[model samples]
Target chain A: MTERYVYMDHSATTAVDRSVLEAMLPYFSEEFGNPNSLHIWGRKARKAVNEAREKVAALVGADASEIIFTGGGSEADNLAIKGAAFARRDKGRHVITTAIEHHAVIDAFHWLEDQGFEVTVLPVDERAMVGISDLESAIRPDTILVSMMYANNEVGTFQPVAEAARICNDRGIIFHVDGVQAAGHIPFNVRDMGIDMLTMSAHKMYGPKGVGGLYIRKGVKIQPIVHGGGQERGLRSGTENTAGIVGFGAAADLASMRFTDGSIEEEVRLRDLLIDSVTSSIEDAYLTGHRTERLPFHASFCIGSLEGESMLLRLDAAGIGASSGSACTSGSLEPSYVLLAMGITHELAHGSLRFSLGKDTTREDIVYVAENLKKIVADLRALSPLWKNRG
Target chain B: MYTEKVMELFMNPKNAGRMEDPDGVGEVGNPRCGDIMKIYIKVKDERIVDISFETFGCASAIASSSMVTEMVKGLTLDEALAISNKDVVNALGGLPPQKIHCSLLAEEGIQAAIEDYRAKRKAGVEAKA
Candidate 1:
C-alpha cells in the first residue's frame, strides 16, 4: 500500500490539459492584442478569437456566430435567463424552470421572480428527472422562456430536454439548456436536438477557468445583460478573454476525439465498474441518479446514516479526493437541494457522495476508490448512532 | 475550516461507540439537521467511571462528542453538568462559528445523561421502599 492520490471530483473542476495550456500561452504575451482594437495586433487577436469560437461552436453543432463567449458558466446562465426574459418581456411575463436546476439558473429565476415575473418551478421524479408532461403543463400562454439543464450537476440525471425543447418550440416560448456539466462529456448538437440556447463551461472540461460560452440559435431573442463597448456582437461587451478562449477552444477540439477514439466508451466502462463496485460492496447504499441514463463519467450515491462530511474526511485521510452534497460540507443546515427534490429524505441525503471520473480515470483507479470507499463508509457508520438504529 | 486539534479529535475520537448496560444515556440533536450525538456513561459514587459516544454528524460533531466525553469521564454528576459547550470548544481549540452548535449538542448530551442517571437513582430508591 504505497501512498496514492486519486482525484475523482471532476465535477468540481479539472486540471487544465497540457495542449490547452500550450495553445493559451502565446496569447498572454507574444500574441497579446485586444480583439476590440482596429490595428494589426488586434486583427491577429480577433483571428484567434474567431478560430476559438468556431471550435467551440463545432463541439455543440452551432454556428460560430451563434456562440457568445462569457466569463464562465454561471455568467452564461445568467445572461441566457435574464437576457431572454428581458428581451421578450413585451411578449410575456411568465417563465418556467425545474427544481433540480443548478443555482446559477435557479437563482436567476429567483431574481426574475422578484422583478414581478410569474415563475414556475416544476418538481422532478425520484430519479431526479423532470417529466416532459410537467414541463408542458407548466408552460403558460404568456411564458417567455423555459430554462432547464441538460444534465444535473449533482446527480448526473439527464433531463428530457429534447422533448422539453419541442414543447417550448410548439408554444413559441424560448428554451435554454444549461449544458455546463454535459457539454464535453456527452455529445449533443444544439441544431440536431432543436435546442435554442445552450450553456457550457471550460473548467468542466480540461480548459482553464474563467472562460465559457453560450450557444444562442440565430433569431433567438436575447438582449445583452452586460452593456459596454459593443463586443461579442453586443451580447457580451468587453475585451475578450483571448488566452482563456484559446484554451477553451483547444479543450473543445480535444473533446471530439473522445467520441471518435472510443474514449467515451472506455470512460463509461470504468464508470459502471465504479458504480457497481461501490453499490454492491456497501450496505444500504443506493444510487442517486438514473441508473442507465446518467453521464458516462458520473457515479453518485447516498449511503447509510453517517453524515457526508465525515465520510469525506475519512476518504481524504486515505488520499482520495471526492465530493459530497451534504449540508455540513456546504456549511449549511440543509442537505443538497437536488437530492431533496428527488424525494430523498434529509437524513439519507446527508450522506450524499459524488465521484465524477475524468479522461484519465482507469480501472485500477475505480478499484482503489471503491475499496477505500467501503472502508471509509464502514468506519464512519461504526461511530454513527443512526447507523446503530437503522432498519 | 477546522483547527488541527479538531481534526485530530475527529479522526481519532477518544470515546466513541455504544456502551453495554450503561448507567445513563442521552441523545441530542436531530437526524434532519444532519447531526445527532448519543452519550453513554458508567457512574460509580455519583462520578462518571467510564464514558463513550456514538455520533451521527460532521467532523465537528464527532469531535465535540469525543471531547465532552473525555472531559467528563472522571467528574461528578454536578461537575459534568457544569461543563459548557464553550468549554468543549475551547478544549478543541475553538470551532468555526457555524460549527459551534455541534459543541452545544455535546454539552446538552452530557447534562441529559447526568439527569437520566439521577432520575434512575431516585426511581430505584422509591422501588426499594
Candidate 2:
C-alpha cells in the first residue's frame, strides 16, 4: 500500500490478521458440534472451549472458570454494571464511575439511575485522569460498585486502575474495569489490579467484532443480562459464537505471548513517531490525554479551527482511513464530551483527530500521515475566520 | 479546494464577532456544536439601517452570520425577515450539507434579534406614545 493508504483508526477496530483467521476457520466447519450437547463431538467442542478459556485466563492472570463469554463489549459491560447493580440493589443504591468512561458503562449507569440508583461521575484532570483521592472521597456507605476504564479510547490515557481497585477493595465496593481498549495493547492482570469484574471485546484486539468476554471474580454476583438458553454458565444465555470465540482465543494467546515481548515497545515507538512528526510539523496542534501514562497504540490531537469530521473526510479522500471526535459522536453536533470534561473548549474538541496505530503500523505510515495532516490543517485554517497566526 | 468566493466569505466574514448589550440579543445554542452567532441591529425609521454581527463558530458559520448582517443592512424588517437560508447559500455559491445548518443558524440569529427588538418596541408603545 502507498503512503496514502495508511489506516490510523486502530482504536475504533482492527483488521483481522490472517493467522487469527486461520485459527478460527476449522471451528466453523469440522468442529461445529454444540459444546452443551451430550455426544463425543460435543465433548470435543467443550474441551476446545475450555482450552480457549485457559488462554484468555492466562492473559489476565485469572482461573479459566472466572471468564464468561458474551456477545460483545457493551453486553459484557452491561452484564457487569446493570446486572451487578440490580442484583445488589437491596444492599446499596449508589455506583461510582469516572467521567471519561465509554458509553457502555455510562449508559448502563444511566439505566441504573432510571431504576432509582444514584451514580456519581468522578471528574478527570487535564491529562484525563481520575484522582484516587477523589474516587475514595466519592465513595459512600451505599456505594456498591466502582467501575473505571483501563485506558480511554479517544485520548489513550491509562487510568490508575490498580489504585482505583485498591480504594474500591478497601471500602468493600465492587471494582470493575472496561478493559476493551487496554486488553491487548497494555499489560493487564486482573489479580494484580485487584479487580472484581472487567470487560473486553475481541474486536478491540485483532479478533472478530461480535465476540467479547467479561471477567467476574470468583463469588462476584451478577444477574443475567441476556436470558435464553442455559449457555455460558447461565450468566449469558445463548448458543456461543463458537468460531468467533476460537478467533478470540487465538488473538488472546498471541497478545499473551507478546505481553513482555518487544511488540509493545515497537507500537509505542510508532505512536511516538506519529506524535512527534505531527507536533514538529503542524502549528498550534496540541496533544490530548496523559503524556506518559497513555496506550502505546493511540494518539489524539486537535488542530486549530478545522472541524474533525471535515478533517476525517479529507484524510479518507487522500486514501487514509482515519476517524475523528466529531465523526464518532455523529448526530449531536456537539464536540467530544471527553475533551470537554477535561476543560478543553467545545470548538477545540470539534477540531480534534484520533490517530490510532495497529500491529502492522510502521514508521513510513506515520511520516505519510504527518505530512498530509500538516497540509490539511494548513488549508482548513486558511479558511477559518477564527484562525490567527499563533507562531 | 473551495471556490474563491466561498473562501472569501470564509476568510473575511463581515460582522463576525459579538455585540455587547444591544437593545436586543439572541443565542441559539451552547457553543459546543460549531459556533454561536449573535446579530446586532441598529434600526432607523422601522428599517434596519445599520447592522453588525459577532460570531463564535467555524468559518462557514462566521461567513453566513457576516453575510446575514450585510444582506439586512438597508432593508425593512419585513424584507429582512423574508431573507431565506437559500438566499444566503446562493450568495455564498454553495455550502456543504453539514454547513447548511450554519446558514440556518445565521437566519435564526437574525429572526431572534428582530423578535427581541419588536418586544422592546411593544413595551415602549405601552409606556407612552
Candidate 3:
C-alpha cells in the first residue's frame, strides 16, 4: 500500500511554489538574455532582474539597489562576513560571532583566523540564545565585524538580532545577520532592526534553489569575493541567475503578503500542535529551543534513548519526512555542534529531531505525524537496550 | 545508506531481548559513543542452545547484533567464538564504511558472553572440588 507522504523538513528546503514557478518560466525561454547585453532581449531580462531585486528588497524593507543576489544562502553569508572583514581590514582584524553560527559563517571565521585575524566565539545560553551582554563584552577596539544568525536551524531558537545590531552600531562595528532560516517565517524589518548586512536564501521560502541575496544597508562597505562580470554593484560579481532570481522575488512577495494577511497563523498552530503532541505523548521527549521565542514553523525535540537515525528511518517508512542530528545521519560520530553549544549532553543531542512546517502543511498532516512519531519512537525505544536500562 | 537485508534485519531483528537465567551475558560498546550491544547465551553440553540480544544504537548496530545472534544459535562454544565481525557484515549483505565498527561490536559481544560462560563453569568446578 502507498502510504500518505507528509513533508516536515521545510527548514532544509521548501518545494518551489506554483506561483513562483510561473513567474520564472518566461525568464528561462522567452527572456533568456544576459542582463548586461544592450539588445531588446537583454533589456527584458534586465527589467525582470531589476524587478526581482525590488521584490526581494521590499520583503526585508531595503532599497532595491542594496540587494546583491548570489548563488545561495551560504554564498550570501560568505560575502557579508568576508567582504565586510576585508573592506575594514585597515581598522581592525578582530571579529566577534556566536558558537552556534552555521558553518558558512563559522568556517569563514576559521579561514580568517588562519590569515592572522582574531575571532571571539561567544557562547549561548541553554535555549541557544546568545546573550547581549556577552556580545557587548566580546567587542574590542580592533573588532571589525560581528556575524550572528537570526535563528538556529537545528533547535529553532530565535536570537536577539536587533539587540546585537544595536550593540554593534554603538561600537561602530559592522554587523551581519544570517537570516536564511528566519526571513520568510518571521516578521522583521532590516531597517528597524538596524542590521548592516543580512543574508537570506530563496529555497528556504518556497522559491527556486541556487538563488539568494545579501542586503547591504546603504553606505556599508563590502568587497566582492567573486570577481567576473562586475554584477551586484561589484559586491557579488557573476552573470545573473535570471530565472532563479525571478522565482525568489515571487516567493518573497508571496511570503510578505502571507505574513501580512496572517496566513502564517495556520503554520504556527500546526507547529505548536506537533510540538505539544510529541512532547506530551512520548516519555522523556524534551523540547530543544526557546519555548516561545522560536520560529513559527519549527518544532524540535530530543526523545530519550532513541537514536535519531532510527527514528527518522521509521518515520520515512511511515511516509513522513524529518531531519535529525544523529551521528548516523551526519556521517560523523559526533552529535550536532549547535546542540553541544547549548549545553545539551552528547546522548541527548544524538537523539535530536527537527520538524519544520511550511505553508503547505495541514492540520491533518500534523495529526498524522504526531501519531506516527509516537509509534515510531515507542518502537525504536522498545528495541533499545538503553531505554530498558533507564527503567 | 543500508542494504535491503540490513534494513530488514533492523526492522525485525532475530533473537532480540534479554533471557532470564541465561548461562552468560555480554555487553559491549558504550552509550556515549552511540552504540551498545548486550548479548545473552544459553549453553547445554558445550553447544549453544539459545542466544538473544538487546542493542541500543543506529540501524547498523541493531542489525549487526541481530545477525550475529542468528549466526550463533545452536552452534558449539568454540564455533560461536570463531564467528568474526566480517561474518556478521557479510550475513547482512554489507555495511557502510562508517558502520563497520558496529559489526565489530557484535563479534566482541559474542566473545564476551562465551568468556563469561567459561569463567562461570570454571568457578563452579573449583567450588565443587
Candidate 4:
C-alpha cells in the first residue's frame, strides 16, 4: 500500500533502525546460543551480551557491570520500585514519586503501598513539572527511595533529575529515574546525575521492542524481582533475550554517537511550526505545555470542545498520525492523567492531541499535517453546537 | 480511523450553517467532550425546509454535526426524530467503533433541536391562538 500516513507519535515507539535490525539477525539464528550455557557458542553469545552491557552502560555513562537487562522499561521499573522497597523494608517503608509518573512506576508504587509502604505522590505545576522543593518537603525519616522520570512522556517536560538526585544524595535516599522517554532523545549521564537506578527501553531509541536495561549504581543492594538462573547478576532472571539485547546495544551506541545530531533541533523547529500554524488558524486552540522549556520534539494542544478521538481519526485520514495521549494508555476511557494532574480541566483535557517529531520527520511533513489539520478542525467546528452557541 | 460515513459527512457535510433567521434553535454538549453542536431550523408549513448548524469540536464531532444538520433538512419534525444513530452510521458508511459515540451525540443533538422547536411552538400557541 502507498504510504498513507506520516507517523508523528515517536514518543510512543520509534521504527527499528535498519542498522540495529541487521545487528540482531545474526544473534537470532547463526549465533543462537544461551549465554548461560558453557560452550564456545554460548561464550560468543555471552560475549555479545557483555558488549551490549558495555554499550548500554556507555550510553548512560555507567559502569558496564551496572547494566541489568530487563524485559522492558516497565519490568525494569517494577524491579527498581518493588525490589528496592522490599529489600529495605526494615530501614524505611516509604517511597516518593510524582503524580504524573508513567503507569509502570505508579502501579509499582501501588504494589509497594499494598505491602505497607508509605507512598507520597508529589504534585506538578501546570506544565506537568514536579517541584524539587515539594520533593524535599515530601521526604521523611522513613523515605527509602525517590523515583521520578527524567522527562515526561506526554508533554515532554524536562524534570530536574540532577537536582532531585542531589537532594536524594544529601539525604542518602535511593533515586530511581524512569528515563524510558528521556533516553536517546535527550542527553543523560547516570553518574553525573548521581542516580542510584535508571530505566530505558529499546524501541524508544530506534531498537527492536521488548528489550530494555536498568542502571544499578554499585552497592545499591536491590533484590531481584524475579527468581531464576543467576543472569543480570541475579537481578532480572530467565534466559536472556540475546537478539533484542544486541539490537538495544546497537541503538544505544548510535544514540550516544548521534545524541547531538542536528535532527533534534530540526524536529523541535517542525514541532513549533505545526503548533503555531494549527493554533493560529483554529480559534480557541491552545498549546498545553511550558511554551519554551518542553521536549524539543513535542507539540500538545487542545482545540475547544472537539473530541480528541474524532480529530485523531480525521487527522489520520488526512495523512497525519498523531496521538491523543501516551500510546501506553491510548484506549483507556480515562482522560490524560498527566494533564489532569497538571490541573487542566476535564473538558479541555479530553480534547487534547499530542504530536511528537522524530529523525525522519520533516518540515514538509509538518506543514502538510498543519494545513490539513486546519481544514479538518474547521469542518468539525462548523458542525459543533458549542461553536454555534459561542457565536 | 474515520468511518466511511463520518468521512463522507466531514468531506461533504449537509446543512452545515445557521438558517438566515432560524425559527428554532437548539444547543447541546460542552467543549470538554470537544463537541458542541447548535442546530438552527427554518420551519415552513410545519416542515423543516431549511437547516443550518455550527459546531466546535474535533473533526469527527464537527463532521458528524454537519452530517446531522444536512440529514435533518427538508424533513418534518417527526421524521427527523425517527433518524437514529444507526441511520447516521449507515449514512456515513460506517464509523470506527470508538466513534460510534459521535453518531450517538449527533442523534441527541438532532433530537434536542426538534424538542426545542416543539416547546417554542407550544409556548407560542398558548400565548396566542
Which predicted model would earn the best DockQ? 1
Fnat of each candidate: 0.94, 0.26, 0.70, 0.70
Which ranges of candidate 3 are over 4 A from the true structure? A389-391
Q: Write the per-residue lDDT of candidate 1 for residues A74-130, one digit (tens) a residue.
A: 999999999999999999899999999999999999999998899999999999999
Cα distance off (Å), candidate 3, residue A283:
0.6
For candidate 3, the per-residue lDDT at A371 reads: 96
DockQ of each: 0.92, 0.18, 0.79, 0.46
Ranking the candidates on TM-score from highest down gives 1, 3, 4, 2
Candidate 3 residue lDDT tens string, A1-391: 2369999999999999999999999988888999989999899999999999999999989999989999999999989988999999999999998999999999999998998889999999999999998988888899999999999999889999998998889889999999999997777899999999999999999999999899999999988899987888887787899999999999999999998787788878888899899989888999998988999999999988878888888888888999998888898999889999999998888898999998988899999999999888877776777785434
Question: A134-230, model 2: which lDDT tens digit per residue?
Answer: 9988999999998999999889999999999988888888998999999977777899889999898898889888999999999988899788887
**Model 1 bad stretches (over 4 Å):** A389-391
For candidate 4, lDDT tens digit of each residue in A34-55? 9999999999999999999899
Deviation from native of the Cα of residue A238 in model 1, angstroms: 0.8
Error of 2 at B80 (Å): 12
lDDT of model 1, residue A61: 91
Give Cα distance to truth, residue A261, candidate 4, Å.
4.5
| lDDT tens digits, residue span B1-129, model 2 | 345555677555665444455666666634456666667787777788777775545556766877778888889988999998889888888887777888898789889888989999899999996
Ranking by lDDT: 1, 3, 4, 2
Ranking by DockQ: 1, 3, 4, 2
TM-score of chain B of 4: 0.87
DockQ for candidate 4 = 0.46
